[model samples]
Target: MGVRVLGPRDLSAARAVIARDPVVNVFVDSLVQTSGLDPRRGAEVWGYVEKGVLEALCHAGGNMVPVGAGEAALRAFAAYALRRGRNCFQILGPARAVEVLWEALEPHWGPAREVRDDQPFMVIDGPPVITPDPLVRAVEPVELPILYPACVAMYTEEVGVPPQTGPDGTFYRSRVAELIRTGRAFARIEDGKVVFKAEIGSVGTGVCQIQGVWVDPERRGEGLAAPGMAAVVELARQLTPVVTLYVNAFNTPARAAYERVGFRTVETFATILF
Candidate 1:
């Protein structure tokens, strides 16, 4: 078996590999649908071929994500990634695959900043079970000023660091604005403050990945998250048939909220953040 950079010519075959698990591969599949292995899109996919079949791929860029990778494929991808140097901030994918790949890369790229090994990959493919929160609605573009701080707070609280270190938060702000513009950002705002918020971060292959789910610390026990997520599921299904998200296993409340909204664990993922 050999691993090599995939190109536009390999689009169909590469997509076949991603299609093996649409839910787990939605992030990379979205990139393939939009960019088709074009490096200009900020990433390139590396394919692993065995017995003349394209069996696995790694999305190489800011986030290195492996799809359909087995034990052998993981080893080959690790060698390729090692040769390419550590340019990614994280290595994330199916739990066992990421575990094996990191086993190969850690010696060379030791001392990772963090390793999140127990993330439940959950999905909801049908209408939400709970009544959707009528008050939870898509954020309007003009409301970015209100939503922006909540986003930063969510990022800092979840990731253990603020999204931006400097006073200027242009990049993170622009991303939030884009989500709002696309009607993918949802929030429950009261008194000009975001009480709960989430965004559809990645969409492809009839699946959409939800990210940045947040409930205001002050409003934690007020029963906001589940209905807010139910509202998000109703809105998200307008764009894709399936809604998926992953949560740190330690985040019991968030996990319970998602489950209450009709999501179920389908897989496990691991993240090695550097």
Candidate 2:
């Protein structure tokens, strides 16, 4: 009947809702798995209740993501988010749910920096069809210098803004380093330069999400993506059963590469970026 911020006591209920579509909800699920619905850990999960049943949920933090949200739930989440005054840089979810949430927030949070309405949510559970790139391997802490610039370039190109603005990229730098430390960062570094790179951005018990996929601009069109991705997928599946990612629909070349690696469009995602 209404939405409320969830906590550790609500973890089981919240996770039940997330498990409704594990792949599509992997990002939020991973957050819950890692943080256990504890807001102090950095983010909050908002749960919508209908007659005492936790029916839908939204992960509220740097990225506001909804899981299994229908129109009614989306509206409730929007009101809650509007009251919180838009702390997140983006609102993303299933295409229709994101549309509904954006429609509700547009009155107050109007004029988003960008609205990506057609992002294909792709997934690959089995081994990749293409040959794995032998050069692609887990990045080491010592290789952070080579990998950092590539991560920045990729973020700027894909998201239209650098991950950090100030001269010090410490926050973003630490994130990349953490991924490397945990063996989640992968890249093909040749001659002290990163040719291709990606990270296992989120990891749930049964699924993992890939993000920040970037190929060196000068090295594009050389058929490196598919094989590089194959290597990443080959490695990622070791931690989880499924690997998933979402790409802007307009990026045909990237889409083609993903398809060549055997990723299929399982759902459509939309993002309203602030």
The ten-residue window of minimal lDDT in model 2 covers 161-170
Give the TM-score of each candidate. 0.96, 0.97
Model 2 Cα lDDT, one tens digit per residue, 1-274: 8999999999899889988899899999888998888888869889999999999999999899988888899999999988888888888889999999988899899899999999999999999998999999999999999999999999999888889644774889999999999999999998999999999999986899999999999999898999999999999999997999999999999999999999999999999988
Pairs of colliding residues, candidate 1:
none
Stretches of model 2 off by over 4 angstroms after superposition:
165-168
Tens digits of per-residue lDDT for model 1, 5-40: 988989999988888889899999988888878777
For model 2, give the RMSD to the true fold: 1.2
Cα RMSDs of all predictions? 1.5, 1.2
Q: Count clashing pairs, candidate 1.
A: 0
Candidate 1 structure lDDT: 0.92
